[model samples]
Target chain A: MSARDTILARVRDAALARPEAATNREAQVAERMTVGPKGIIPHQGQATGPQKLRQFLEKLEANDTTVTRVSSEDEIAHAVARELRKRNLPAAIRMGEDPMFHAQDWGSLDVSRGPGRLEEPVTLSRAQFAIAETGTLVLTSGPDNPVTLTFLGETHFVVLRTEDLRSGFEDMWGDFRKRGLDPRTVNMVSGPSRSADIGQVLQLGAHGPVALHLFMVG
Target chain B: MSGHVPTSSAFKSNSQEALVNRNLQAALRGSRGNFIAKRAAARANVPEFDDIRDQARDMKNHVLANLDLYLEAYEKKVTEAGGHVHWAETAEDARRIVLDICRKSNAKTVNKGKTMISEECGINDHLAENGIKPVETDLGEYIIQLRGEIPSHIIAPAVHVTVPEIEEAFRKHHAHLPPDRDLSELASLQAEARSELRAKYFEAEVGITGANMLIAETGQSVIVTNEGNGDLSQSLPKVHIVMASLEKIVPTLEDSATLLRLLARSATGQEMSVYTTFSSGPKRSEDPDGPEEYHVVLLDNGRSNMIGTEFEEMLRCIRCGACMNHCPVYQSVGGHAYGWVYPGPMGAVLTPSLIGVEEGGQLPNASTFCGRCEAVCPMRIPLPKMMRSWREREFEKNLTPSATRYGLGVWAWAAQRPWAYRLAARIANRSLGITGKSKFSKLPLAGGWTKFRDFPAPQGGTFMDQWKAGKR
Candidate 1:
C-alpha cells in the first residue's frame, strides 16, 4: 500500500476505536470547513472607526514600525522621500505595477517599477488590508505588489489607506474574501524583520528590511 | 550526522555532564529568565489569553478526532491549488521524498527556514550526504549548523553556544574574511552573518520550511517567524517544500487565528510575530516572482500511533516551547540533556512514544513533577500526568533500572502492611536521631541524594509515634 493509504488507515482505525466514534466524523469535518466558525474574538479586536485606527497606530509604534498619515493620496511620494532623507537611505525605490503607485508622480526620488533584485535598498508595496488589533498589514502576491519587494528591500515602505484598515484578523479576512482575491501567498507583516538568535539580543533587519515605514493615506 | 543515534538511554550521564559544562551553563543561565519574563509580559497585555488557549485546545481536539477526514480534505485542496502533497509514514520515507524533489529540481544548494520537523527528520544530513548543500537561514539555526550540531533548543537552536564560541566558529568557517577584524560588539557579529547569508539566499534551487499551521479550508501552509528568512527562503527558490506533521492541520482560517493568537505570545511574548506568511501553492502565472513548484510533505513518523493513547494530548502542541521555558528541570539541565530532538516536559512524554520506551524510557524520570510545565502549557496538556504514565509503562516493560525497581519494591512491600511500615519507619527514625548530627553529609544507601547536598536528619521519632504520643 502507498504511505498515504497506510497512514490514513491507521489514523482511521485509532479514531474509530474510541467509544465516541459513533458520530459521523466526515460530516463533522465537512461542516467545519464550510461553516468556518469564528472563534473567540478579543474585545480589542472588535473596536471600530477612529478608535481602531488609533489602536493600530499605537500597536505599530509599540512594535517599532514607523507610520506617517498623509491627508491625501498625492502626498505619498513626498512622504516617502522625506522618510528616505530622514533615514539617510538611497533616493531610489523599487516598486511593482500597482495603479495607485502609477497615479502618483514621484518628484525627485529615483523610482523604478519591477520585481526586487539582489541589492534593493528601498522597496514599496501597497497593503490590501491592515489589522488594528495586532497592527498587521495584509499583502497579497501579484504584479501589483510583487512578494519579493516585501522581503528583499533593506528598508520597506508600505502604503495602506485608512479606509482599508480592519479591526482585526476576522474583519480583514472577511474583506479579503469579499474582494474575490486569490493570491499565491498572503503575507501578514506586523513589523520589520528581527532576530534574537545572536546572544539572545533582539536585533532588527535579519534577512529582511531593517526599517519598515507605513504611509497611511486617508 | 546523517542519522543521529539516540543517546537518551544515557540521559543520566548526559545531564550529569551538562550540569558542569561551563560554557553550556553560561549559555543556559544567560537565556534562563528571558523567555519566561517575555511570555509573562505578553500574557499580561492580553486579558483573554487563557480563554483563547482553551479555545485553541478544543479546536485541536476536534481536528484530532477527525484527523483522517481533515487530511484528505487538506490534500484535495493542495492538489487543486497546483501543489503536491506527499505522505510519509516514517522519517526515512520523509527523507526520501524530500531528496527526490531536490533531485528532480536539480538542486545543488537548498536553503532552509527554521523547521523543527526538518530537524526531527534529519533532512540536512541527508541532503549533504547526497551532495546537495543545505544552508540554514535562521540566525540561530545557522550558528548551530556552522558548528555541525543539531539544534539544542527548538526555537533558540544555539541556546547552548556562547558568544565567543560563535565568533570562533564564524572565524574558522568564514576564513575568506580577514582574520584581524574586530568582533567585540554583538551588532558587528550580527552584521557579519547578515552579509554572509544574504548572498547565499539567491543561490539555492530549493527552499524547505516547516509550517506552524496548515489550513484545510484554503490549502495554505502558514509559517510564523520573527525573522523574514522563511519568506525569502521560499520566495527566492525555484521549488518550495514544506515539511509539516499531519497534526498541524486546522479546520479553517479562523481556527488558525485562535492558534496564532496564542503561539507567539506563548513562545516569545510577542503579540504577533514579525511575519506570518500563508502560502497556498506555487506562484501564480501572472506573479513576478515566487517558487515555481510547491510541495507539502506530511510526515506522520509516530504521530499516528499517539492517537487513542495516553500521550494523545501531546499532539495538541503547537511547538510553542512554553512548556520547556517554564520547566524547572529543563532550565537547569538545558535541552541537550534530554538527548534527542525535543526536550523538557514535552520531550519527557514524547521521546519514549516516538523512539520506544526501551531506548527513551529514562527521560520520564528526569522530571521533578513540579507541575509548572502544565501550568504554563498553552494547550493545557497534562504533561506531568503523561510523564507519570510513561514511568508506569517503563516499569511494566522492565525498562527501569534495577536499583530503582528494587527500591520501589521495598517501599510497596512495606506500605501494604501497616505494622511493618510503622516498625520500619520507627527504626529508621531512631537510628537517624541517634546520629546527633543535624544533617548527614554521607549516608549508607542514599549517596545519590547526599552527593549534591546534605540530607537533614530526622528529629525524635516517626510520625506514627508522634501522633500516638500527642494523643496521650
Candidate 2:
C-alpha cells in the first residue's frame, strides 16, 4: 500500500481503538471545519472604540514598532519621506503597484514599483487589516503588496488606515472572509524581526527589517 | 552527519557531564529565568490565558481523535490549492521524499528555516550526503550547525554554547571576512550573520521549513517565527517544502487562532510572534514572486501508535519549550543531557514513546516529578503522570537497571505488607538516628546521594509510631 494509505489506516485503527472514537468522528470533523467554532476570546481582544486604538498603539510600542498617525491619506508620502529622512535612510523605496500608493505623488523620494530586490534599503506595503489585539498587520501576497517587501527590506514601512483596524483575530478573520480574498500567503507581522539566539539576549533586525514604522492614517 | 543516534540510554552519564560543564552551566544560567519571568508577565496580562489553554487542549483532543478524517480533509484542500502532500511513515521515508523533490529541482544548495521535524528526520544530513548543501537560516540553528552538533534546546538550539564559543565558530567558518573585524558586540555578530545569510537566501533552489499548524480548512501550513527567515526561505526558493508531522493538523483557521493565542505566549512570552505566515500552495499566477512548487511532507514515524496508548496526550504538544524552561532538572542538566532531538519534561515522556522504552527509557527516569511542567503546559499534558507510566513500562519490560529493579521489587514487596513495611520503616528510622549527628557526611548504599550533599539523620521514631503515641 502507498504510505498515505498505510499511515491513514494505522491512524484510523488507533483512533477507533478508543471507545470514545466509536462515535461519528467523520461528521464531527466535518462540522468543526464548517462551523469553525471560536474559542475563549481574551477580554483584551474585545476592546472597542478609543480603548481598542489605545491598546493597539500601546502594543505596537511595546513590540518596538514605531507608529505615526497621519490625518489624511495624502499625507502618507510626506510621512514616509519624513521617517526616511529622520532615520537617515536613502530617499529610495521599493514597493508594488498598489493603486493607493500610485495615487499619491511621492515628491522627492525614489518610489519604484515591482517586487523586492536583493538589497532593499526601504520598502513600503499597504496592510489589508490591522489587529488591535496583538498589534499585528495582515498583508496578503499579491501584485498590490508583494510579500517579498515584507521580509526583504532593511526597514519596512506599512500603511494602515484607522478604519481598517479590527479588535482582534476573530473580527479580522471575519472581515477577511467577507472580502472573499484568497491570497497564496497571509503574512501577519507584529513587530520588527528579532532573535535572541546569541547569548539569549534579544536583538532586533535579525533578517527582516531592523526598524518597522507604521503610517497610521485616520 | 547521519541521523542523530539516540544516546538517551546514557542519560545518566550525559547529565553527569552536563552538570559539570561550566560553559553549558553559564549559558543555562543566563537563559534560565528569562523565559519563566516573561511567560508569567504575558500570562498576567491576559486574564483568560488559562481558559484559552483549556480550550486549546480540548480542541487538540478532538482533532487527535478524528485525525484520520482531518488529514484527508487537509490533503484535499492542499491538492485543490495546487500543492502536493506526501505521507511518510518513517524518518527514512521522509528523507527520501524530501531528496526526490530536491533532486528534481536540481538543488545544489537548500536554505532551511527552523523545523524541529526536519531535525527529527535528519533532513540536513540526508541532503548533505546527496551532494546538496543545506544552510540553516535560523541564527541558533546556524550556530549549532557550525559547531557540527545537533540542537540542544529546541527554541534556543545553541543554548549550551557560550558567547566566546560563538565567536570562535564564526571566526573559523567565516574566514572570508577581515580577520581583525570587531566581533565583540552582540549587534556586530547579528549584523555579520545577517549579511552572511542574506546572500545565501537568493541562491537556494529549495527551501524547507517546519509547519506550526496545518489548517485543514484552508490547507495552509502556518509558521510562527520571530525571525523572517522562514518567510524568505519559502518565498525566494523555487520549491518550498514543509516538513510537518501528522499531529500538526488543526480543523480550521479558527482552531489555529486558538493555538496561536497560546503558542507565542507559552514559548517566548510574546503576544504574537513577529511573523505568523500562513502559506497554502504555490504562488498564485498573478503573484510577483514566491515558490513555484510547494510540497508538504506529513511524517508519522511513531505518532500513529501513540494515538491509542497511554502516551496519547504527548501528541498535544505544540513544541512550546515552556515545560523545559520551568523544569528544575532540565534547568540543571541542560538540553543536551536528554541526548535526543527533544529534551526536558515533554521529552522525558515523548522520547520513550518515540524511540521505545528500551533505548529512551532513561529520559523518563530523569525527572523529579515536580509537576511544574504540567502546570505551565498550555496543553496541560499530564507530563509527570506520563513519565511515571513510562517508568512502569520500563520496569515491566525489564529495561530498567538491575539495581533499580531490585530496589523497586523490595519496595513493592514491603509496600504490600503493613507489618513488614512498619518494621522496615522503624528499623530504618532507628538506624539513621543512631548516627548521632544531625546529618551524615557519607551514607552506606546511598553514596550517589551523599556525594552531592549530606543526608539528614532521622530525628525521631517512625510516622506510624509517632501517630500511635498521639504526636500526629
Candidate 3:
C-alpha cells in the first residue's frame, strides 16, 4: 500500500480507538472549513471609527513601523516624497500596476511599475487592508500588487487608506470573501525585517526592507 | 562536518562538558533571563492571553482527534491550489523525496529558511552527498551551517556560539573579503552576513522552508519569521519545497490566527513577527513573481505512532521554546547536552518516542520534574507527565540501570509491609543521624548526588515514632 494510505489508516485506527461515533467526518470538516469559526477575538481589536484608527497607528508604531497621515489621496505623492527626502534617499521608487497608485501625480519622482529587482532602494505598494489588532498590513499577490516588492526594497513604503482598516482578522477575512478574490499569496507584514541571531541583539533589515514607512491616507 | 551520532545515553557526560566549556557557558549565561523576562512582559501586556491559549489548545485537540480527516482536507486544498503533496513514512523517505524533486528541477544550489524538520531529517548532509548545495539563509542557521554543526536551540540555532567564534567563522569562510577589515561590532558582522546571503538568494534554484501552521481551509502553508529570509527563500527560487510534519495541520484559518496570537508572544515576546506569509501554491498566471512550482512534503516519521497514545499530547507542541526557556535544567546545561535535534522538557519526552527508549531513555531521566515546563506551555501539554511515562516505559522494558531497579525493589517491598517499613525507617534514620555528622560529603550508595552537592543528615526518629509521641 502507499504511504498515504497506510499512514491515514494508522491515524484512523489510533484516532478512533475508543470509537467516538463516526458521524460523517468529511461533512463535519467541510462545514467547519466553510464557516471558519472565529475563536476568541481580543477585546483590544474591537474598536471603531477614530478610536480604531488611533489604535491601529499606536500598534503599528509599537512594532517599529512609522506612519504618516494625509487628509486626502492627492497628498499621498507629496508624503512619499517627504519620507524619501527625510531619509535622504534618491527621488526614485518602484511599484506595481495598481491603478490606485497610478492615479496619483508623482511630481518630480521617478517611479517604475513592475515586480521588484535587486538593489531597489525604495518601493511603494498600496495595502489591501490594515489589521488593527496587531497592526498588520495584508497585501495580496497579483499584477496590481506584486508580492516581490514587499520584501525586496531597502526601504518599503506602503499607502494605506484609513477606510480600509479593520479591527481584526475576522473582518479582514470577511472583506476578502466578499470580494471573491483568491490570490496565490497573502502576506501579512507587521514591520521591517529584523534578526536577533547575532549574539541575540536585534538588528533591523536582515534580508527585507530595513525601513518600513507608511502613508495613511483618507 | 562532525559526525553527529545519537549520544543521548551520554547526557550526563555531555551536560558536564557543557557546564565546563567557558565559551558555551558565557553564551548561555548572556541569554539566560532575556527570554524569560520578555515572555513575562509580553504575557502581562495582554489581558486575555490565557483565554487565547486555552482556545488554541482546544482547537488543536479538535484537529488531532480528527487528524486523518484534516490531513485529507488539507491535501485536497493543496491539490486544488495547484500544488502537490508527498507523504513520507520516515526520515529517509523525506530526504529521498526532496532529492528527487531537486534532480527533476535540475537544482544546483538550494536556499533554505530555518526549518527544524530539515535538521531532524539531516537534509543538508543528504543534499550535499547528492552534489546539491543547501545554503541556510536564516542568520542563526547560517552561522551554525558554516561551522558544520547542528543547531543548539530550535529557535535560536547558534545560541551556544559566542561572538568571537562567529567572527572567526566568518573570517575563515569569507576569505574573499579584505583580511584587515574591522569586524568588532555586532552590527558589522550582521552587515557582512546580510550582503553575503543576498547574492545566494537570487542564484539558488530551489527554496525550502518549514511551516509554522498549515491551514486545511485554503491549502496554505504559513511561515512566520522575524527576518525576511523565509520570504526571500520561498519567493526567489524557481521551485519551493515546504518540509512539514503532518501534525502542523489546523482545521481553518481562524484556528491558525488563534495559534499565531500566542506563538510569537510565547517564543520571542513580540506582538507579531515581522513577516507572516501565507503561500497557497505556485504563482498564479496573472501574478508578477513567485516560485513556479510548489511542493509540500508531509513527513510523519513517528508522529503516526504518537497519536492515540499516552504521548499524544506531545503533538500539541508548537515549537515555541518556552518550555526550555523557563526550564532550570535546560538553562544550566544548554541545548547541546540533550544530544538531539530537540532539547529541554519537550525533547525529553519526544526523543524517547522518536528514537527508541533504549537509546533515548537517558533524556527522559534528565529532568527534575519541577513542572515549570508544563506551567509555561501555551498548549497546556503535560510535558512532565509525559517524561514520567517514558521512565515508566523504560522500567517496564528492563532498560533501567540495574542498581536503580534493585533499590526501587527494596523500597517497594518494605513499604507494602507497614511494620517492617517503620522498623527499617527508624533504624536507617537513627544510624544516619549518628554517622552523618550534620552533612555528608560522601555517601555509600548516592555517589552521583554527593558528587555534585552535600546530603543533609536525618533530624531524628521516623514520622511514625514522632506521631506516636504526639508530635503530629
Global lDDT scores for all candidate models: 0.91, 0.92, 0.90
| Docking quality level of the chain pair in candidate 3 | medium
Q: Residue by residue across A99-134, what tens digits does model 1's lDDT show?
A: 999999898889998888899999999999999999
DockQ of each: 0.80, 0.84, 0.75
Q: Candidate 1: list runs displaced more than 4 Å.
A: A35-37, B464-472
Chain B TM-score against the true chain B, each candidate: 0.97, 0.98, 0.95
lDDT of 3 by residue, B1-472 (tens): 3124677888989999998899999999999999999999988988999999899888787788889999998999999999999999988899999999999999999999999998888899899988999999999999999998888888999999999999999999999999999999998999899899989989999999999989988899999998899989999899999999999998877787888888999999998899998899899998888999999999999999999889988999999999999999888899989998899999998888887898889898888899989998999999999998999999999988898999999999988999999999888798889774999988888887998899998887888988999996
Write out the backbone clash pairs for model 1: none
Q: Kindly report which residue pairs in candidate 3 clash with one another.
A: none
- Among these predicted structures, which one has the highest DockQ? 2
Query: For each model, chain A TM-score?
Result: 0.96, 0.96, 0.94
lDDT of 2 by residue, B1-472 (tens): 5688999999999999988899999999999899999999998999898889899999999889989999999999999999999999999999999999999999999999999999999999999998999999999999999999999888888888888999999999999999999999999999999999999999999999999999998899999999899999999999999999999998878788899999999999999999999998999999999999999999999999999888999999999999999999999999888989999998888888778888899999888888999999999999999999998888888888799889988999999999999999999899889868899888889999999999998878998899999996
Candidate 2 share of real interface contacts: 0.88
Q: List the residue pairs that clash in candidate 2.
A: none
lDDT of 3 by residue, A18-134 (tens): 467356767766776774446788887677888888889899888889989899998988889999999999999999988888898999999999988878999999898889989
Which of candidates 1 and 2 reaches a greater DockQ?
Answer: 2
lDDT by residue for model 1 (B1-472), tens: 5656788899999999999999999998899999999999989888998999899888898889989999999999999999999999988999999999999999999999999989888899999999999999999999999998888877888989999999999999899999999999888888888899999989999999999999998899999998899999999999999999999999888888888889999999999999999999899999989999999999999999999998999999988899889888888888888888998888888889888999899999988999988998999899999999999999999888798899999999999999999999988888988979999999999998899999999987788888889944
Residue B32, candidate 3: C-alpha displacement in angstroms: 1.0
Candidate 3, fnat value? 0.78
